[model samples]
Target: MFEKIEMMRMARALGHHASQRQIAVARNIANADTPGFKAEDVASFTDSYRAASEPLRTTDPRHLAAPDWSPADRRTLAETGVSPNGNSVSLEEEMLKGAEVKRSHDLSLGIYSSALDLMRTSIGRRA
Candidate 1:
């Protein structure tokens, strides 16, 4: 019972994280037109996975893992182009990123739902 609950909790956490990434990607796409706007991405899944899987052994408080995006690591990789007023937002790239994030969110939801279903089956329905 406890293990089932733990699995469900982990799945929920992953789903939540993926949802945040999707939201961030959508925001980036929406702000592509504004001047001085820079595209932003949440921290990579690799970082999140590492933080979740690894045991924390930090001596200093500052060394703890961040639960969200890192502004310092954010990069503006949009191509240079002129829209009559110099802006680097690439519609193609933004669209692709948005699609990818949406897929990721769907996948996360599937995993969570499937795990919950399995747990329910294992518990067996009361007659």
Candidate 2:
């Protein structure tokens, strides 16, 4: 239920999420050969949606903290540079992530087009 709703919300952005994800993946791949380059991953907007969807149960008035400090704060990229090289980005991982992002993006566009086509047909019938 949540995944579908999140995907629908993403639909409104017209593939923005997928595009940004692709860009991030590409950046990671590009920096793969560079030294001290940490791979950056795209955060799923669905996480925020899920957090907002969950019912908040506060036992006390001060139970709820600031929204910014919420545990649901999405962290996409992993922290690197604990070592000297600081090169955490891996080409293989970046490529795989990129492929997945591309597939999802294509699927999203297909769904969007189909929905638009259905709307067109409905209007045409009315006419």
Considering summed lDDT, which 10 consecutive residues are worst modelled in model 2?
66-75
RMSD of each: 4.8, 6.6
Using TM-score as the measure, which candidate wins? 1
Compared with the true structure, all predictions reach lDDT values of 0.62, 0.63
The true-versus-predicted C-alpha distance at residue 68 of model 2, in Å, is 18
Cα error, candidate 1, residue 34 (Å):
1.8
> Which segments of model 1 are wrong by more than 4 Å?
1-6, 58-86
Highest lDDT against the true fold, candidate: 2
Please state the error at residue 57 of candidate 1 in Å: 4.0
- Report residue 19 deviation for candidate 2 (angstroms): 0.6
Tens digits of lDDT, candidate 1, 17-113 = 6676666667766877787666566666656655555565778888966443222343334444546444556778767877777777777678777
Per-residue lDDT for 1-127 in model 2, tens only? Answer: 3235444544644366677777777787777767777777756646654565567677888785534213232437755442357778867667777788778788778877666676668778531
Off-target runs (Cα >4 Å) in candidate 2 are 1-9, 48-75, 79-84, 125-127
